[model samples]
Target: MGHGGQRDPSEYRKITAEVFYDISRRKNGVRPCPGQGFPTDIKIECSKEIRDYPVGTKVRLDVVETDKEGSRPFLYSSYKWEHEVVE
Candidate 1:
């Protein structure tokens, strides 16, 4: 089973061999930590997986790893966070 298929989104700090990022209107981006400043502000509003992130929990999702395409290696931890009951 895949991570999102079998693994529960509430019991682990999900990390994968993947990464994806996109700049808003500029060519460069200053990724702010989900709970930190602009850009990286953790906004899970309207998302179930994200809206579930409890205050203080760290979470990221939908990262696209594209090294074969031609870009360098990088990660964007700007998915969503939720409180997971660590079993």
Candidate 2:
């Protein structure tokens, strides 16, 4: 797993990786020490046979950028699993 945060709003940041997974889980672990365990943000609820993919599968992510109104304008990004790669 990787961890990152917004450093600037106007610049573009790149995340380089060789492989991607079809399933993923996100958790917020930014609290102070002695905090609660990692709370799940997303997970597949169905049985593995209904919705399962081979491990180490490459997946495509759909990213959306939006502007938030505040004292200072900030860019926010949201990502989702768009599709699985055939090759």
Candidate 3:
């Protein structure tokens, strides 16, 4: 017996950011409207990679924040997550 009445284990995927301060809350899918979205929160130790992605960089978050939440393996079909960064 569970509280949420049992979620379909098959349909759920755990997301984790590497070297996180704290794994308090974990989200499954996070997307933006008409754009690519971060499927999960980020916890990257390499700030350089995070920094190099300057404005106008159409980037796909292919890194893992934690072992639990492996990466957003799939891409969103509706919205193109490419960012047109402004200087």
| Candidate of highest TM-score | 1
Assess each prediction's global lDDT (C-alpha) against the native. 0.32, 0.26, 0.30
Q: For model 2, how does the per-residue alpha-carbon lDDT over 1-87 read when each residue is reduced to its tens digit?
A: 122355443343221111223332432111111121212222222222222444433332222233445533222223322333432
Q: What value of lDDT does candidate 3 attain over all alpha carbons? A: 0.30
Predicted structure 1, TM vs. truth: 0.24
- What lDDT is obtained when candidate 2 is compared to the true structure? 0.26
Instruction: Flag the better candidate by lDDT, 1 or 3.
Output: 1
User: Model 2: which ten-residue window has the lowest total lDDT?
Assistant: 27-36
The Cα error of candidate 2 at residue 83, in Å, is 1.6
Which consecutive 10 residues in model 3 have the weakest lDDT in total? 75-84
Estimate, for each residue in 1-87, the C-alpha lDDT of model 3 and write its tens digit: 121323353432222222222335342232222222344333332333423543333333323222336653432211211223222
Tell me, by lDDT, which candidate is best.
1
Q: What CA RMSD would you report for each candidate?
A: 10.4, 12.6, 13.5
Q: Which residue pairs overlap in candidate 3's backbone?
A: 15-69, 16-66, 16-69, 17-65, 17-66, 18-65, 18-66, 36-81, 56-85
Q: Predictions ranked by lDDT, top down? A: 1, 3, 2
Which residue pairs come into collision in candidate 1? 19-64, 34-42, 52-82, 53-81, 53-82
